[model samples]
Target: MSIKYKFHDPGAIYFVSFAVVGWIDVFTRSVYSDILLESLTYCRKEKGLNLHAWVIMSNHVHLIVSSREGYLLSDIMRDLKKYSSFRIVKEIRESTIESRKEWMLYLFAKAGQQNSNNKNFQFWRQDNHPIELDPHLNMFEERIDYLHNNPVKAGWVTNASDYLYSSAIDYEGGKGLIEIDLLV
Candidate 1:
């Protein structure tokens, strides 16, 4: 892993992205995505995650985030991924309506078996690919725009703010599913 992608400055905000293993479209169902949303909410309330903006796509998530004082961004991200992975994998395993349950579980189990770090399954890819943002460099707006417009770019919605799984609504002066620490 390159040091460039690592979280070096705890106070500096960062743009991060993590995808499901194999880029599987697991989040096509709201039930699964809701698990992620709940986890993000929990992290925000309890883990000191300063979430500025975010989006949940079909198989991945993007965020502009940092840690509050006395918290480490890396630690928060690790716990987020670890908890979400376990919950999402368990949900898929136990879901009676998940048509692709067996296939998804098989893939996760295969990925886990191939990787020495996992014991049973690997739901999320290991790398967060974090990019630290310098607050003084006028990067927040650009990143937020890019993050919010992801669904629009994908043709899922005409306007970014219309996407239900993103913080674009908050940016548009509407409350979203989760709270956001707005960045100017």
Candidate 2:
């Protein structure tokens, strides 16, 4: 098998995006999204994930991240995805409020069966599509803008900063849900 995106530079920041299998809109519910947030928080605090910006859409997540001095961004991302997938799938299995619980679980199981890497469920697609950002070339502004404005483009909010599931608010000089290492 061939991989499209690779984490070549260990110290460089990357803009990475990953989606749910079949592009399912699993994050439409706050419970599922909250699980993702919790996982990200854990990574940031314990796994040396240096987050610059992030956004969680209905089916996917985009993050601008790097690793701390002794950590690898790729390793951090792998753990984040693994833990979040297990946690979210468990939530779906036990949730009393999820309207699409059966359907979502069935799809996840089917996807898992097809992928040899997973034994039961596959909540997230494998590729992060990590694109390293060049600090000297002013590439961050463009990626950050694109990441922040995703909710606006999706018609979820009129203003990007008004969206709660993103770092847009933090960039606007307001506090966001998770801590971010603001890009300069």
Candidate 3:
């Protein structure tokens, strides 16, 4: 029932990043990313969320998003995080695809049990440091470029659009994994 931080200003553009707990590479596989996509899709359709840009890296997510009808961005992010954590954990624990990763997950799970009141592993970092996009402060373009070039910067792919989990392609030519609301 606590009010989210982004609720204070409904019309502000926010660039937010949420890292995985322990920065584990939970999203190196598409399982967790798929869950994130599903949750985002639901939020966008049901709650009138405006997604400006997004990038799902190995252990973190960068999003340039706003909302419609006074919807709170923080609440939407919280829902996405919660749902992805649940679905990904369940998937990881049962799937043979992630079975060989037992030790890493066990450690993550133990950390979660210790950190949270729940009995399962946690997925995302608790702190969501959303920087308000202010063109005056000169951070807006920096964040946008960072999100677009992250995969390329990481050497995962030569072109930003080559990363299948990012919105760079959507910006370039609409060949992205998901629909994007072009900011410009």
Can you write out model 2's per-residue Cα lDDT over 3-122, one digit (the tens) per residue?
445888999999999999989999889888888999989999999999999999999999999999899887898899889999999999998988899999999999989888778999
User: What's the true lDDT of residue 84 in model 2?
Assistant: 93
TM-score-wise, the better of 1 and 3 is: 1
lDDT of model 2 at residue 154?
A: 98
**TM-score of decoy 2:** 0.96
> Which stretches of model 3 miss by more than 4 angstroms?
1-7, 136-138
> Scored by Cα lDDT, where does model 3 land?
0.79
Model 2: CA > 4 A from native: 1-5
Worst 10 residues of 1 by lDDT: 1-10
| Winner of 2 and 3 under TM-score | 2
Candidate models: Cα lDDT each: 0.90, 0.91, 0.79
Candidate 3 lDDT by residue in tens digits, 88-164: 77787778867546876776687677774456676677766677887687676678789999999999999888889
lDDT of 1 by residue, 1-184 (tens): 1112478888899999999999999999998889998999999999999999999999999999999999988889889988999999989888999999999999999999988877899988886679888777878988999999999999999999999999999988899998889986
